[model samples]
Target: MTDTPWLTVVRGTAPLLLSIPHTGTELADLESRLSSPWTARCDTDWWIEKLYDFASGLGATVVRTGISRTVIDLNRDPSGASLYPGQTTTGLCPTETFDGDDLYRHEEDKPDAAEIEERRRTYFDPYHAALQAEIDRLRATHDRIVLYDCHSIRSVLPRLFEGTLPVFNLGTNDGRSTDPALQEKVRGILADTGVSYVVNGRFKGGWITRRYGQPDKGVHALQMELACRGYMREPGDKASPENWPSEYEAAFATPIREKLLTILQSAIAWANG
Candidate 1:
C-alpha cells in the first residue's frame, strides 16, 4: 500500500485553506467495480488543481484529494445525507452517476453497505483527517481561517441543473458561512469583472463549508463551483476517453484564473479582519 494518501499539500502565509476535493483522478481498487470506466471520471473537477495552482504564490494554503470521487465523495456528509436535499447530486459513496446511470454495471457488482463503509474507513476518513489537521494547524497561527472548497463540473448537466450554469457559482450557504461584508466583497469583485455569477443559487457550500464555518468562532467557509466550459472545450456529443482533458485553452481560462486570485486575496483579507 502507498504510505501516503494521494494528496498534495501546499502551505501558505495566508489564513486560508483551499480544498480541491473533485480534482482527483485515481481509481485504484475501485476501477474494476465501475459500470463504465468513462462514467467514473465524468464528474471530475478537471484542471482545478492547475487553475488554483497560483494560490501558493499568493500565500494561500492548498489541500487536494487525489482519489477519484467515485471511491467516496470527500465533500459529502458521510451519513449519506444529500448536500442539496431534494436535488440531483450524488452521495458519499455514489451508486449512480449524475445522469441517473448505474455506476456499477450489475447489481451484484455494486458495493454493499459494509463495502461502502470499508471504502470510507480506507479513503474518506483519511482525506478529511488531513483537511481538519491543516485547519487546526493554521488556526494556531491566525485569528481566523477561511476554508475555500473548490470544485467544477460540466457547464450543463441536465440531471443537476435546468439551464447552463454561470461561469462562477459562489456559495456561502446564503451568507451564513462568512461575514456579509466579506461575501459582498467577493461578489463585488465578480460583478466588476463582467463575469456571469450567482450567489447561493444551485450550490451552497458542502460538508466542509457548513461543518466548519463559524465566523464567531473564527472559522469561515466558501465554495466556488466553476463551469467546465469556462476552462475546457467539452465535446458537444460524448466525451471521448482519448481527448479526456478536452483541449483547455489558456486564453479563456486565464480570466477566470485572475478572478480566482482576487477572490483568494480578498478572502485572506477577510480572515485577517
Candidate 2:
C-alpha cells in the first residue's frame, strides 16, 4: 500500500518507467459539481492502465493516478498552456469532453482559477512528484532511463481529429523526447505488426514527455496513444453517450496487447543498450 494518498506507484529495478496518467475515473468531492458521473468521465483514457498491466512484470516502474481527468489532467501543462496551440485540447481541469460536451452542471460550476490551483495541489502535483521520484530511482542505477507514457482514446472524435485515428500513435516531440534509434525500434515493432501506425502524428507527446524528457541527460520519454477500437469494440461510427466506452474484453485486446508487450520489452532493451 502507498502512503501517498494521491498517486499510485510500483517500484522496479529496470530503467523503464510506465506512466498511466489519464485512466483515472474518480471525481472525488467534485462529482456533485460536475454534470454527471458518466459525462465527466467520458473522456477518460479508459482501461489504459489495465492495457499495460504486464509492464510491472517486466520490471518497469509504474506510476499512475486515480483522480479523473475532469478533476485535473495529469499530462497537461499545469500552467494552462495548450499542448497543441491551435488545436482543441483539454485543459488542466477540463470543462468539456473531446466532442464538446459540457462537464459541469452549470457554466459557473466549472472550476475557477483558485479552485484549479487547489486541485493542482491535491491531484496534479502528487502524480508528477511520484513520477519524478521513480525516474530518479531508476536513473540512479541505469546509465539511461526510458519513460513510456501510456494512453488511449476513442477511435473517432471528430472534434479531436478529422477521421478515425490509426491503431498506434507514437509521440516523441519529433524525436527530441527520446533517442532516434529507440523511436526506430518502436516503429519497427509497429511495422512488423502490419497495422496502421504513425509517429509524431496528431499526438506528439504531452507535458510529461516534454517536461521530464531530457535525452541529452540520459533520460528519454515517449507517449504511446492507442485508439480504443484497436483493442475494444468501439460502438459504431460515432461512439455516442449510451454505447460509448465498451467494456474491457481481454480476448479482444490480446492481439494489440501482444504488440504492446513487445514494444515495452524493446524499450527496456534500448535503455539497457
Q: How well is each residue in 25-124 modelled by candidate 2, as lDDT tens digits? A: 7887787788888898888888888788998899988998888888889899999999999998989988888889888989889889999999989888
- The candidate maximizing TM-score is 2
* lDDT score at residue 205, model 2, on the 0-100 scale: 97
lDDT of 1: 0.83
Inter-residue clash pairs, candidate 1: none
Hey, what RMSD does candidate 1 come out at?
2.2
* Residues 243-265 of candidate 1: C-alpha lDDT, one tens digit per residue: 56585677878988888888998
- Candidate 1's displacement at residue 273, Å, is 3.3
Q: Can you tell me which runs of candidate 2 are displaced by over 4 Å?
A: 1-6
List lDDT for all candidates, in order: 0.83, 0.89
